[model samples]
Target: MAPKTTHPVLGARALNRATLDRQLLLRPASLGIPEAVEHLLGLQAQNTKPPYYALAARLEGFRPERLSALMESRAVARIVTMRSTVHTHTARDAVALRGLAQPGAIDRELALFVSRGGLDGVDLDRLAELARALVEERPRTPKELREELLPHWPAADPQSLSVAARCLLPLVQVTPRGLWERGGQVALTTTDRWFADSDGPAAGGPADLDETVLRYLGAFGPASVKDMQAWCGLTRLGPAFERLRPRLLAFQDERGTELFDLPDAPRPDEDTPAPPRLLPEFDNLLLSHADRTRVVPADLRGRTWSGNQAHRVFLLDGLLAGIWHLDEGKERTTLTLEPFARVTRADRAALTTEAERTLRLMTPAGVPHDIVFATR
Candidate 1:
């Protein structure tokens, strides 16, 4: 019998550097907005601005308007793909990933609603067909959708009816809803209708889950099967990893967790310099892994969240160092940084510099900005 291949080991710092390189945070990459959006799989877009700020931190020459234009042009869209949460994805990924995730994450989410008795009497197939026609005819807000869907299932819970619509269909939050500086109320439409006029890939097809695994590794690799499963909110992915093993490089993390990454993917030196970054709330880098210790220090694990909400975070030396928020004013925008611990003058200066870059890229020109370190 052939001897089993022994995997090499990777320490935490080594893993952090490798993951950061793939994340495009080792340095700003010169990539266009649509390409970057597709490369990263998608940006965690629980809020309107996270995707733009996410691109600004990872890509060179990124402007919020660039992403906004993609939204307007239907080259990218906000949809529920991974983790049963909304993400801003490229037009192709928006279609493929959603279809791939539907069998697992999306179905499970709808089951949760059904289990709660909210969809007890509703025929799901009928609901999906009606909701698809309703939204595809013209986009509708959650309220409008729920109200329209409720009468058909008068016995069903109103909130659950709309949530069911979302879970049942590959709904896209239409333009103006996610546009920069031109935000509007959440509106819903079928991905088919939303991408109907675009030259990009059309909606509804079986996405190759194996191909998705490779893309997942390119963007979030040096990751374990569980990591990708956690990132995408799917399970039973071990077969995919096994199938790709011959083409992958395997290494064990300190905990003996086997990590599989693309053979040519960058694994930067452990001590490679990782500059500070200011990330928006719910950024994927912080959420897309089972072992976040690669980026989140152990002691500060739960500090980035309150109740169920995530705070915008800043990284010092490529680890979660602080939480930050902005106070926009007519004359000035104040960026308040709250570090978990005291920092050296050098670290503080570096954080300030990154904060300035973010403000310049995200805020309107000619708006004076202030960076304040709150007393921890």
Candidate 2:
């Protein structure tokens, strides 16, 4: 579809370049682990390794151990913030963003579980108090938390009690769970206890919704209200956009949907070179926006997932081009690429160089690595 003529429009490629620049994908950024986590809002961390791989993809001279150290020191943590999924966030954002999200996304998710009739006759306030006390004393795994809470409310669903605690409190996944190379099972604690020594926003204090909107533009802008909504899993944000309209720049997309961005935010040339990127499954670059055509091609929609699982994907020239799988052997590590379409020789070379760089940093040294492009 052609861009609408009524207003200055950003076509798909234009949007792609601008968003990639904001995402630190066009080039590796020179930023520390916590700073990068805050700037990108958070790293999708449904799995332990994605956050490390995500940092490797975006940061120059990134060592997995650096992030691991941060996790050990309470500098960053994994929590269920945006989209009600786990994200590795800076210490401060872990408090602020989770507080921001609690009223809407967290509560709504708990409601879904409540409506299932499992939480019948349960006093939500009592559940929150008991669960908070238990975790604050020490971090507890979801299973342990559920088992303890089940005895108190024998009639209530075991899982629902644990879910209620997560919703009612600003729970965070404690250390060793998110530490790279030293992984552990999921464990929960309130942000208040976890970041008690830290200085910044406190638990139960959410950042202003208006300020968050502006920050979202800075990171993933020229975006529609729906796009922002999709990223954070909050609704009725049109008012926040309206209040900031005077301070923002508005443009129409090809569909004539109004998009908002910071006036000074980078809107790179449409033809700017975008190197191939190997992103972890559920990377925010692919999941943040409602209209994903800017990053995902039309024909490749829904190709990233199978049933309920998401595959690790790679980009060629800034678009979703293929799936990648990694196999670790005692003697050698192999990375196989399965492209959605035939790749040109130049793109193939670039992909290999990128894969080797990732392997050197991620895999053990002296382990020979191979990058193979699978025949479709």
Candidate 3:
């Protein structure tokens, strides 16, 4: 057996600290915005706008337009990653993730739509070939892609076509829909055309979940295989860890749940001071865990969920301390903090200061509203 740490590797705080180190939230990050974006599997851009704001908080100097440019140039693409939701990831990741995620997404759609008789005996390979030819000339909206393919697969429900094509071809919704500050509608193209302008995905193939797993633990380490699965939405990560056994350092939590970490990964003392930070709504840290009690207090988790149920949030000492809203249409921003319990005057001041600065940055030319506090 490999020798374990003398102290038996303390509990979840140790794990949480390891996660903090990899994430750079324990301290300010030194990596470039693009690199940080890549490591986090493209910053979870479902709402389309918060990834920009999220990066600005974590990265030292981030600009929304740079991500926009990367999207336009196809260096990083917008595609589905974990949980089968849209993410803005690099070209390399987009391909691999699609390969792995497509099968699961297909199984889901087939159950949901197949009983409706949309794909009885339909040859998907033939459909993919035809769909590729149909869209190669230009990027088409989802509706357009459906119409073009409908004549051949008349039995296929037009509304279900987008989900079917998503599983068949590694498709990406092209910009200016994904561009920062752009209101452009979603336009469709295969990930190849969206990234490399070819109709085919690169031959190298599916993203190795083992390699992807190591990178995940590298960025969010001292984490369990369960946490690994939560972050990547892949089942059977045990094999990935098995392949990685030689390279990893292992421990057991208080519950004796086995956990893994990178050998040289950072593990700061629990007392190590953490700064106040505002996280974007749906930021992966909050999403990428099964037992959020390690980070969010159970009493407050419901409040955090309800507060950020819409748009954005603020973090004080790594917990979701409050929620912030940006009312762009009215050119005003308001921050509502629902403290689980009473907060110190000093911490409240700190949150206010951070909230004010972020609001100003997000709504630079707009009128400002006084920050609001509501306790539940």
Candidate 4:
């Protein structure tokens, strides 16, 4: 066997700065929404508001209407892609990345359905074709799609049928559901129909996976293969990285796990001052890494999750500091900052200022908003 490659060692703080800089979290980026979305690979958007909040926090002049227009114009879309969850991705990535992730997502969905006897005699290929036809005709809510598919697979569970299609196909969540300040049911369309005007077809096979690995490294790297797997729910990506090894930079974290990143990516000094900022629920920063200690303190990791949902968290000095929630009233909105540990006076003041700026980005101009720190 070839001798083990020695890489630079990066402590947790150094890794934290590198990741934050790449994530556009250490400082807001100057890029437009679409460019930023592509760079980040996509934002966790199980809920409509998180994408807007995420971009607002990361972009220099992000506006809710900007993202809304992207959705309205088919420049970006909400789709079930990474980690088998809804993400708001640029239209290009919505197509390219979904195809890369579909195989595993579909297998998991089918396994669950089969174990429950919900997919008992249904032919998945036929189901996919039929589901594709239905969604292609027009974007339909999961309920509406389920109802239509039920007639064909009458014995299969309605929910399972809809989910199988979601897993198997590249379905894009149509506008209004993901539109800023607009509430609507989750609706689905095929990527092909949704981005018909785009250059090439949705990417597939190993080549796209290679692209995905590079993009992940660019956005969240100095990460291990396990971290990439955790982020995208795709396994066996080691070979993909191996192929690009010469083009990549390698590092070892404090724990000795080898990390891979783009050769030219930023790795800032460990002492870099990370600003106080609030992250949206299920922010990728918390979810993207298998070893998340770079951003989340080991002692506080267990606290970030409340059942299945991860709460919106705040960061100070590039580490998880607290959780926050918004209380929107008709006339005024209150942002409550709840810290996990004792905060110094200086940190608290900075936290308050960041919270106020976040409120301005999140709420309408005329709407009043206030920031309150929850007393321990």
Better of 1 and 2 by lDDT: 1
**Candidate that would win on lDDT:** 1
Over 157-184, each residue of candidate 2 has an lDDT whose tens digit, in order, gives: 8888888888888888987787776788
Which 10-residue window of candidate 4 scores lowest in summed lDDT? 198-207
Candidate 1 lDDT over 1-376, as tens digits, reads 9975568998989988988899999899998887888889999999998998998899997999988888898999999999899999888889888988887888998999999999998999999999999998899998998899888889889999999999989999998998998898899998888998975776658579899899889988799999999999899999999998999999998888989999999899999999999999999999889999999999999998999888999998889999999999999999999999999999999998999999989999999989999966
**How far does residue 328 in candidate 3 sit from its true spot (Å)?**
2.6
The lDDT, on a scale of 0 to 1, for candidate 4 is 0.86
Clashing pairs in 4: none
lDDT-superior candidate, 2 or 4:
2
Instruction: Give candidate 3's total backbone clashes.
Output: 1
TM-score of the candidate numbered 3? 0.88
lDDT ranking, high to low: 1, 2, 4, 3
In order, candidate lDDTs are: 0.91, 0.90, 0.71, 0.86
* Candidate 3: residue 364 lDDT (0-100): 50
Evaluated against the true structure, the overall lDDT of model 2 is 0.90
Worst 10 residues of 2 by lDDT: 196-205
- Local error of candidate 1 at residue 230 (angstroms): 0.3
lDDT of 4 by residue, 1-376 (tens): 9997777899999999999999998898999888899999999998789998898889997788888887888888888887789999877788777777776654676688878999898998998999899999998888988899899889889999888888878888887788877868888888888888643244433227777788899999889999999998888888988998888988898878999999888999999899997999888989999999999888986887778877888999989999998999998898999999889999999999888888777788889888888953
Better of 3 and 4 by lDDT: 4
